[model samples]
Target: MNIEWFLVLSALLFTVGLIGVIVRRNPVVILLCLELMLSAGALALLAFSRMLGNQDGQVFVLIVLVVAACEVVVGLGLVVAMYRRRLPLDVDEMKELKG
Candidate 1:
């Protein structure tokens, strides 16, 4: 029931997500990690908002959720496109996407 507990959980989620993003090779897994990171941030924001007894952070968290949803849509679209093109799903081999 403490703000510190929420913050600690958020930090742990963020750390796990960071590690996943760094260690995973698959694009899908990377995207999932990125979502995890976003969720962690949103969780922290909600915690702070609750602690402060304000609506601002909740509004921002809503915006963040919208952005995260957009990111997932675009990311999955790209992944599907790549799969349709018979491209490798591995992030390392995605260097060809560089312009």
Candidate 2:
């Protein structure tokens, strides 16, 4: 497989995720976009790590997975809390939680 193609694909995926994050107003959709971005980053890291014959990137992917899991758990917790308050899912309407 061509490494350049992998890199390009990852870039495109990340770009789409970023665009989604910026354009979407819903917190849940934004969280999904963040996950997409994270997966794209992991894909690029794994591809380069494979090209260089290194296991370090593979280990780093485990860390990314853990972080992503934590992010989802926390994000969902916030979303659920927001819902409990009978608030809209729109990000702009979440000002009450702000410090």
Top candidate by lDDT:
1
- The stretch of ten residues in a row with the least summed lDDT in candidate 1 is 88-97
- Per-residue lDDT of candidate 1, residues 43-63 (tens digit): 999999999999999999999
C-alpha RMSD values across all candidates: 0.6, 0.8
lDDT at 97, model 2: 71
Worst 10 residues of 2 by lDDT: 89-98
The C-alpha stretches of model 2 lying farther than 4 A from their native spots are none
- What C-alpha lDDT values do all the predictions have? 0.96, 0.93
Instruction: Report the Cα lDDT for residue 49, model 1.
Output: 100
TM-score of 2: 0.95
List clashing residue pairs in candidate 2: none
lDDT of 2 by residue, 16-40 (tens): 9999999999988999999999999
Model 2 residue 64 CA deviation (Å) reads: 0.5
Best by TM-score: 1
